[model samples]
Target: MRIIFAGTPAFAVPSLRAAHAHGEVAAVYTQPDRPAGRGRGLQASPVKLEAVARGIPVLQPESLRRRSAQQALRDLAPDLMIVVAYGLILPQAVLDIPQYGCWNVHASLLPRWRGAAPIQRAIEAGDAETGVCLMQMEAGLDTGPVLLARATPIGAGETGGQLHDRLAELGAAVLADGLGLLRAGIRPVARPQPEQGATYAHKLDKAEARLDWSQPADALARKVRAFDPWPVAEAVVAGERLRIHGAVAVEEMHGAEPGTLLRAGREGLDVACGRGVLRLRVIQREGGKAITAADFLNARRDLVRA
Candidate 1:
């Protein structure tokens, strides 16, 4: 089968590679290069980088809503179009061009998390389990029917970054299986998403990363994990920015007010929260390398706001 692959981020790279191995990928479509980092240099997306490495043709169009762009995709004469975290809305015209139709590799099960940032939202919501979904493309926002799914438990201490990698791998494997089924003329029965228990996972915002001490310690701990490796959970200490990368919620402590440091040592920094103590295990000073709580407490004594 001749396939057209569409994706942009690191989460989509694995699925793109899997599609290439499963069939002849005629071309790849990705978002245009964007300015990145403090230097603001234009950087190719992860999918584009991988596609270039494999010598696959790449198209970086600003929008596919244009008739010309949709026509360009049709010219490829692809039997199937595989999309994963493509970061663009596919018009119905584009969806109708492929012979076998477009299949999306979504990060979460259908109806549960139906929009951007599903992986992070799942962790932040403290969901017990999350998984990948192979869905047939439609005009609605992830409202398409799911043809295949594979479940995985969300570990208690798992961070968003950790779950993101695992789900990427799982999505690739399920996509491969789904493709095989389609090629063998075995159309897997696609089930409509349940109307109940549906939720949208909105895109993450840096503003939302600010730590709210008034919340319970357990919730704060979850926030740190959910926002790990991106706009990390932040708090101000002695007028200096502090990023909390690792923490655990412990039983409530007496005396100290919320957001006050109750204790600091090699074991952990026990900080009071609304309902319990949050033992900070890993932390980072603004624009500095992440270090253990002990190192941060010792090197910067002013950080402990007791």
Candidate 2:
């Protein structure tokens, strides 16, 4: 079988590699290099870097809607196309080029979370479990029919970064197996996504990083975990910016006003929320590195409620 792979970012690299193992990978498509880093040098996407290193042909088209771009893809004469985290939307003409059709490895189960940022949204929503799905593509959003799926429990203390890495690996395995079945001339039957319980996983926003003490402590803790590794959860205290890295929610019979510092000691900086207490275990002041709550309190003696 000949396959054309389209993807970008680190999450997509594993799937690209797995796709290579099944058959001849005709070509790879990834987003164009963009300016990055302190010096603002052009940086190739992770998938592009990997594809080049493996000697696979690479394409970085700005748009596939153009007939020329679609013609270039049709020239590949691939049996199937595998897409994972490919930032671009495939026009219907391109989706029709491959015999087996385009398939996507989505981060969440079908019909549940069907958009960008599924991993973060799942943790933020406090979902008990989440999984990956292999779906046959259609024009509608992530409304494709699912051909295969693998479920996993979301750990209570899991962060978005952790779940992202785990799901990437799981998606690779599932994709490889799916391709194996295809090679054996078995056309996997795909089931249509359920119409009910459908929800969109909106892209993460910077505003969501700001901690709202008025909300429950548990919710705040989840935000800290969900926003990790990007726009880290933050708080404003005494006109100073603080990045909150770790915290725990505790039941409080009677807590102080929201955002009030109730105690500052080795146990952690216990802050009062609307209905519970939040023990901030790790924190970093603006222009400073992360430090334990107790250590930060030691240096800023004024933070103690004395």
Candidate 3:
């Protein structure tokens, strides 16, 4: 099968490589390089870097809705297209170009989390389990029929980054298996998702990173995990921003005013919350590297009460 692979981030690289290994990858389409990081240097997306290293043809069209972009895709003459975290909406015309239709390896199970930040949303919502789903592409937003799915239990203290890596690998395997079935001329039956219990994974916003001590400790801990490595949970401590990287909920009954530093010792930076205490295991001050709560406390003795 001549496959045209489309994706953007590191999460999509695994599935792209799997497709390349399984069949003939005619071309790879990814988002273009953009300014990133402290220096604002142009950074190539992970999928683009992988495709180039593998010697696969690479295309980075700004928009597929344009006639020129659509023509470029048609020129590939691919038998099928595989999309994972592509970051671009495919128009109906482009989705119709491939003979076998495009298949998407979405991070969340169909009809449950169907948007940009599924992995983070699952952890934020304290979902017990979440999984990857291979869906036959459609015009609607992740409303496609499901082809294959692999479920996994979301660990109690799992972070967004960890879940993302696991799901990426799982998605690669599922995509490979789905492609095998397709190659054998077996069209996998589509399962219509239940209309109930559907929710959108809205993109994470910076404002959402601000931690409100008024919330329960468990919820705050989940927020810290969900936003790790991106928009980390933050709070205003002594008129300075403090980012929380790792935290654990304390089960003991000791409590103080919400947001108050209940204790600052070797155990960790135990901060009181509305219903419980949150032990800040790791922290990063503005313009400084990440450090353990103990290290942070040692350096700034004044934070012991704020």
lDDT agreement with native, every candidate: 0.90, 0.91, 0.91
RMSD of 3: 1.5
The C-alpha TM-scores of every prediction are 0.96, 0.97, 0.96
Candidate 1 versus the native: TM-score? 0.96
Worst 10-residue stretch by lDDT in candidate 1?
297-306
lDDT of 1 by residue, 67-130 (tens): 9999899899999999999999999999999998899999997789899999999988889999
lDDT of 2 by residue, 181-248 (tens): 99898888899999999999999999889999899999988888888877789997645789988888
Write the residue-wise lDDT of candidate 3 on 137-222 in tens digits.
99999998999999999998899999999999999999999999988999888887787988999998999999998889899999
* Candidate 2 ranges with C-alpha deviation above 4 Å: none
Q: Give me candidate 3's TM-score against the actual structure.
A: 0.96
Q: Lowest summed-lDDT stretch of 10 residues in model 2?
A: 253-262
Ranking by TM-score: 2, 1, 3
Give the CA lDDT, 0 to 100, for residue 82 in model 2: 96
lDDT comparing candidate 3 with the true structure:
0.91
Model 2, residue 239: what's the lDDT? 53
For model 3, the superposed segments whose C-alpha errors exceed 4 Å read 252-255, 302-306
Please give the distance, in angstroms, between residue 189's alpha carbon in candidate 1 and its true position after superposition. 1.5
Which of the two candidates, 1 or 3, achieves a greater lDDT against the reference? 3
